[model samples]
Target: MNTADRVDLVTRYTQEVVTDEELAELLEEDSPSAYIGYAPTGEMHIGHFTTMRKLADFLQAGVDVTVLIADLHAHLDDEKSPFDLLDARSAYYEEAIEGMIEAAGADPDDIDFVRGTEFQLEEEYTLEMYRMAAETTISRTQRAASEVVRESESPNLGGLIYPLMQNLDVKSLDADIAYGGIDQRGIYMLGREILPNHGGESPVCLFAPLLAGLSGGKMSASEESSKVNLTDSPEEVADKINDAYCPMGEAEENGVLEYMEYLVFPILDERGENFVVERPEEYGGDLVYESYDALESDFVNEDLHPADLKGAAGEYVSEGIDPIRERLTEQPELLAEAYPDKYGDE
Candidate 1:
């Protein structure tokens, strides 16, 4: 692909790129690497799948992709996944991520999966962390990790080190681009500022847009109905989307439309499939969209009803998630062990 084509591939579905100039420069190189780290904590939902779609984009653009299962970070971040459950959760996360990659129409075998403990314990990495610690003030570290680590009056020291380790991960992994949701912009910006001092190059950052929750506002695992779980059944997905806060002809804060644009449409388009909104003869017949923009335009023009859009979105999302749900079902023991309290009854 030419530079423009390659740049389009990388920046197509992303919310922001650190610098288009830097991305263009990297595209000029023979090979550039991109990496994203996920702390193995909660269920990998449809929101997380959106980032996987970007990973597929990078792969198609000829960038080497690395998936970092940050188990240790999960351990250090107030033990969110629990030390004992880290291995199970990490294993589950890898499988789910691979499923997501495939759902995005990318080959999972082409991607590399790395565990945090693999090299985070190496003396070279540890020494650099100490160097950053010596140079970085506690206040600065807290500021960088503000969005990530939980804040409190007596926050654990691990909270401060979390962002530092994440910063170093780019250098340690030798990645050219740091890909993540926009929330990590703060930490990666700090990484760009700090890494050069330790002889590490600042990574070009690519960010995916955060999708709104079904009920509106941010999507969180804590709010069960707020996000669609990878394992959600067809009925559950339909129910969630149907009851979701989607307004007629209003694009703002519509999670159903967000999924249709970010997750469902991209995957469907890549697979040479059409997005069909089924309706009876009375309700303007079935609206078929070969592109998401068409669907969005119709909705924005008030030609499409919210109910019709929700039904279509649920069906498309379920089709995309079916394989993932089946894959996870084959390994019941993984979820059972990882989230014992939640899945033990099953």
Candidate 2:
């Protein structure tokens, strides 16, 4: 596929489009690089998968890709990160990141991994980055891109430098596009505005919708109930989806239903309502429909109960994890080392 088609596929999957022929032409004449950034600060959760899948899709469409581990940002965000902890637990977190990426079916060769600090310090980039970071005020930086900063209790120097360094990553890589979640919009906008001052064109930003946790809010790696980690077992995924806050007979404005609409529904191509699990013995098995409208109409009209939908969602979520679970089971040693606390208990 050409660049335009590739952009379309990414936009379809992510619903965030950041490419245009004019912009693409400018990038081609200017820098001609494309990359996807990842903050490896926490266990790679289902939330991470949404972006990783987009990154892979971008690469499949022949875009050059870079996946940053963002270790330095992890430390800057909190003093308690695995890197700061400097214990077995910290190393385990790092390994878990690698394992989770591999389990997610990300191509190892396609990813250009880097530690944030090291990437910043390479050549004159580090010195230049420090200078750029110094020019931007804390208030401007905070207002421009401080989601992570606001999330921190005591935003430190690293928190302030985080966006600057991230912006520097785009300039340093000379990338044509940068991918992040909607939460990173402010920082990404900062990159677009500030990067050109340092002689690099601003990378067009693509923001994927955030996936809510099972209990129905932003998924947090720190909160067990708030996320489905990549390491979760199939049964765990099923149970979580089963108990998820998917309101029945309602539109997707509901967070849980929105998760189903954006993440789950798109994966199926057809509407999820079409695949009906007919319980009647006379029916012999489930009845599948080609149109989502029909299925949704049946659901909203009380023809289908919420439990039936949950059952289907549980099965679907379970099946989705089958391959990932197989990879995890095959790497028992890796799992033992990466998740010693959880795996050891079992």
Candidate 3:
């Protein structure tokens, strides 16, 4: 692909790119690499699936990709993933991510996967950590990680060091681009500022938009009703999508529409298929949409009912996640070990 096409692919559907100039220059290289980190603290959900879908775009543009399973970072973030369960959770995360990539119509073999403990505990990495700590203030560190780490009136020392390790990770991983959700902007911006002093260059940052919750607000991990789990059965997925916040002739804060725009349409497009919303003969039968824009236009004009949109979205969403659910089901022990309290009995 040409430079302009590559740039479009990289920036498409993203919330923001740190600098368009830097991204253009980086894409000019024979082989450019980008990395995104995810701490395996909770079950892989549909929200995470949306972010993973972007990797297909990077691969299509010929950009090499790396996924960082930040096990240590998970523990430091208020001990969300207990130290003893880190290995199990990390294993589950890697498999789930691979499944997501394949479901998005991309080959998982093209990407490299790295674990935090693989190099974070080394002597050289440890020395740099100390140097960064000496140069950074507690207040600065807290500010950088405020949106990411759990907030406490008296934060633990581990929380303070979390951002430092993240900064160092860019250098250690040798990434040309640091990709994540927009909530990570603060920590990455801090890395761009201070990484140079620690012998690393500022990376091109790519941030994805966060999807709204099905229940009507920000998607939260603690609230089961907010997001659909990766392992949810097709019936469960349909029920959740049926109960999602979708209003007739209105699109604002509609999770069902967001899922169609972000997840369903993209996956279907990749597979060379159209989105089909089935209806009875009296309701004008089935409606086929080759693009999300056309579908949204019909809905806004009141030509389509909210019930029809929700029913279609649920089917497509369920279809997209079926492969992931099947893969995880083959290894029940993975989930049982990773989250014994929740999946042990099952």
Candidate 4:
């Protein structure tokens, strides 16, 4: 691919790129690398899958990709993943991420995976953390991590140290691009400002749009109905999609439509398939769409019913995730050990 095509591949489907100029320049090089970190805290869900799908774009553009399984950061963020369970959760996370990468049509072998403990505990990394702590104020650290870490009137010291480690990670990982959800904008922006002082250059940041909850608002981990778990059965997937917040003739804040745009359509395009919305012959038969925009246009024009869209989305999503579900289910011990309280009995 040419420079412009590579740039388009990286920039398309992203909410924002910190600096387009930097991305263009970086693509001119023979190889440029990008890194994204995911703390192994919760069960992998469709929301996580959507973000993982974008990595396929980066890989296709010939960018080197690294995934950080931030196990230590997981515990530091309000102990969401207990220290004892970190190993299990991290293992599960790697497997799930590999599955996500493959499901999104990218080779997992092409990406490098790193664990936080691999370097974060080293002497040099520790000294740098202390130096960053000395240079950064408590309030600044708090603000950078506010959206990501749990909040409290009286937060723990670990929460304060979280963002500092994240800033230092860019340098340690040797990443040219820092890719994550838009919610991570604050932390990455802080990294841009502080990394130079710590002997690291500002990374080209890529932020993906957060998918709205299936029920209508922000996707919440506490609310099972708001998101689809990777392990959810096909019947469960259909039921959740059927109960999703998709309104007829309206596409805004519609999770079903967003799912089709971000997840289903991209995967279909990769497989050289069209999104088929099945309907009875009397209701104008099955509608085939090769692009998400065309489907959205028909929906907004009231030619495509919400029910039809939801039905197709459910099937596509289920089919896409079935391999992952089956793979993880076979290794029941992974989930059981990672989330004992929830999956132990199953």
Sliding window of 10 residues with minimal summed lDDT for model 2: 84-93
After superposing candidate 4 on the true structure, give the runs of residues whose Cα lies further than 4 Å from its correct spot.
none
Residue-by-residue lDDT tens digits, candidate 4, 159-185: 999999998999999999999999999
Worst 10 residues of 3 by lDDT: 217-226
TM-score of each: 0.98, 0.81, 0.98, 0.98
**lDDT at residue 95 of model 3 (Cα atoms):** 98
**Superposed Cα deviation of residue 303, candidate 2 (Å):** 4.7
Tens digits of per-residue lDDT for model 3, 1-346: 9999999998988999999999999999978999999999999999999999999999999999999999999999999999999999999999999999999889999999999999999999999999999999999999999989998999989999999999899999999999999889999999999999998999999999889999987889988877889999988988998888888888888888889888998888888999998999998999999999999999999988989988888888989999999999999999999999999999
Write model 2 residue lDDT over 132-236, tens digit each, in one string. Answer: 867888887777656655455556777777788888888777677787787788888888778878888877777787776667656666778666666677677
Q: Give a tens-digit lDDT track for model 1, residues 128-168.
A: 99999999999998888887787899999899899999999
- Give the Å shift of residue 110 in candidate 4: 1.4
Q: How large is the C-alpha RMSD of every model relative to the true structure?
A: 1.0, 4.1, 1.1, 0.9
Candidate 3: list runs displaced more than 4 Å. none
